[model samples]
Target: MEFIIDTVNLEDIKEAVEYMPIVGVTSNPSIVKKTSPKDFFKHMKEVREIIGKERSLHIQVISKECDEIVKEAHRILEEIDDQVYIKVPVSYEGVKAIKKLKAEGVHVTATAVYDLMQAYMALAAGADYIAPYVNRIGNLGNDPMELINELSNRIVQDGYDCKILAASFKGVQQVRDAFNYGSQAITAPVEVLKQIFANPSIEKAVNDFNSDWYDVYGEGKGICDL
Candidate 1:
């Protein structure tokens, strides 16, 4: 399973990527606005440097029309590296853009999906990843896991090369359920992902282990001391 962090903060990306098993970094217009970088392309280049060339970096296009979206995708590729995944919302025009981009061998991630049919359309357009808004769907009084389960089943049955990259998470449980429901990847805020270790019991357990070790090794002494 791929773990992706959805943030534009350089410090958070550097720290999280170092500690977490992160596979990618994803950002949308909203995420970029949060940082308000003076130069968008330069900031993204820095992000690419920190993550290096191995991990994928997903950047979204702000255009609504198919033609503009296609142009934006090309610009993003030129601004960033070609390996970066161009994120397109799953819509009529977006599907067209995805098809055009895929035709040119561009890595495309279909986003803003809330329905099974939308995801199916993205998969048909040869998208490398399809992102379903998990929390948004749940907030709309719909069961997001149902969509994920059915989509997962459909992907396996249809033999699609696409992966389910679940997004819009609020808590760690949402992230866990996304994976449990067969999402191959998830992009969440660094804070939300860090919540996985928020339990007080976890610290207490570690403290207990350390205390026992201290009794034998003496306080502040470690295995290296030997």
Candidate 2:
């Protein structure tokens, strides 16, 4: 499964890439607003440099009209590298844009997906990735895992190349559930991702092992030192 970071913070991205197997970085307008970079394209280029060309970089388009969305997608490709995935909301117009972009052989990610129908539309429109808002769907009193399961089944049955990129996670459990439910990729904040190792028992186990090693080798001694 691919672990993607859903933020625009360069420092967090750098740190996460250093420690975690982060496959991609995603950014929406809200995420971009948090950093408020002076030059958006330049900042994105910096992000690309950090992640390198192998990992994907997703940048959302702000346009609402189909034509403008297509134009913006091309602009993003021109401004950023062509390998960047253009994220379009799964709206009527956005689906149209996805079709157009896909026809042009551009990488597209359909975002803001809340329902199964939205995902179906994006998949039919040939989107490379479909991002469903997990926490937001749960907050709306809908079962996000069920939706993910259904979508996953559909992808396998229909033999579609599109991947389910689960987003909008509130906790580590939600992230795990997303993967358990068959999400191919999950994009969450670094803080939430770090929660995977937050259990005290894990630290205690490590401490206990270190203590045993010290008992045998003397204080502050390790196998590598010897």
The root-mean-square deviation over C-alpha atoms between each candidate and the true structure, in angstroms, is 0.8, 0.6
Scored by lDDT, model 1 comes in at: 0.96
TM-scores for all candidates: the values are 0.98, 0.99
Model 2 per-residue lDDT at 167: 99
Query: Which candidate leads in TM-score?
Result: 2
Q: Each candidate: what lDDT?
A: 0.96, 0.96
Model 1 alpha-carbon drift over 4 Å, by segment: none
Worst 10 residues of 1 by lDDT: 217-226
| Per-residue lDDT of candidate 1, residues 132-200 (tens digit) | 999999999999999999999999999999899999999999999999999999999999999999999
Question: Which residue pairs in candidate 2 have backbone atoms (N, alpha carbon, C) closer than 3 angstroms, thus clashing?
Answer: none
Q: Model 1: how far is 12 from its true place, Å?
A: 0.6
